[model samples]
Target: MSLLHRIEHPRDALAWEGDMPTLGRYTAGIAGEKFFRAIQEHGQFLGTVCPICEIVYVPPRLYCEQCFEHLDEWIEISPIGWVHTFTLVHLDLDGNPLPEPLPLAFIQLDGADGGLVHFLDEIDPEQIFVGMPVEAVFKDPAERKGSILDIAYFRPV
Candidate 1:
């Protein structure tokens, strides 16, 4: 079946509004399980390094995307990273105006090629900027649940 459809006008596009039928659980896969597990168990960040390509994947991957080599070297990386990009969110989840803006950033972890996109806290949204240094703040050991929430948020270092 052809999935593409042509519409003469933007408003003529077909739409559907209702509860979605798609539902399932997301298992973090082999590499992701190791990555998040390290954070949950020890409050540490783990990355996989490719020896041939010499690329470091932050959320460690099972195979090197560049060379297709199996990745088995897991290394602990510093939670410290720099804000590669940032934004101030002034709208709530429902598109309503928020009382205070929320800051979010894509933090490039040191010694890794990729980064994590998460909420930024402990500083004014107006102060956020590119290349700003930040560090992950983890929740208490008892509160961790082997999830991304295990690390509460990233804050200015």
Candidate 2:
């Protein structure tokens, strides 16, 4: 039997002399790209409103989930929103303790039926309450690249 070796770090694994098959490369499709671009370039929030149900989807959808209608109406939505719900996470993505607790929230933008799950900033975790009003803080126009991170985080209003 051969000894089993473990990869402690990605950088260390680079020393291996074998083919490393990789399989993960996720991407946000066309609708998401369009939404991100609007925010990244113009500092605007975009949503798609369904004509049939009048429901709006943020991160605008190509088609309505409810009525299955093709969504063609793209409307701008306010970045100001309320936190529908949230959680205080104390660990990092690697399950290690973070220096501080982070608030992850589901923010429901005004005038939109659906909400977005994103990080919250500039507030104490203890002070975080459901229905708390928040607003998006975007990166400088020159720094934006049409990514969700373009809006750094939502801060208490």
lDDT of each: 0.92, 0.90
Per-residue lDDT value at 85 in model 2: 97
Question: For candidate 2, what's the RMSD?
Answer: 5.3
Off by over 4 Å in 2: 1-20
Q: Which pairs of residues collide in model 2?
A: none
Kindly give the stretch of ten consecutive residues in candidate 1 with the minimal lDDT sum.
1-10
Q: Tell me how many clashing residue pairs each candidate has.
A: 0, 0
Clashing pairs in 1: none
Please report, as a residue range, the 10-residue window in candidate 2 with the lowest summed lDDT.
1-10
- Report the C-alpha lDDT of model 1 over 63-131, residue by residue, as the tens digit: 998899999998989999999998888999899998888888899999999989999999878788899
Q: Which candidate is the best by lDDT?
A: 1
Cα lDDT of candidate 2 equals 0.90
The TM-score, computed over Cα atoms with residue i paired to residue i, of candidate 2 is 0.83
**Cα-based TM-score, every candidate:** 0.85, 0.83
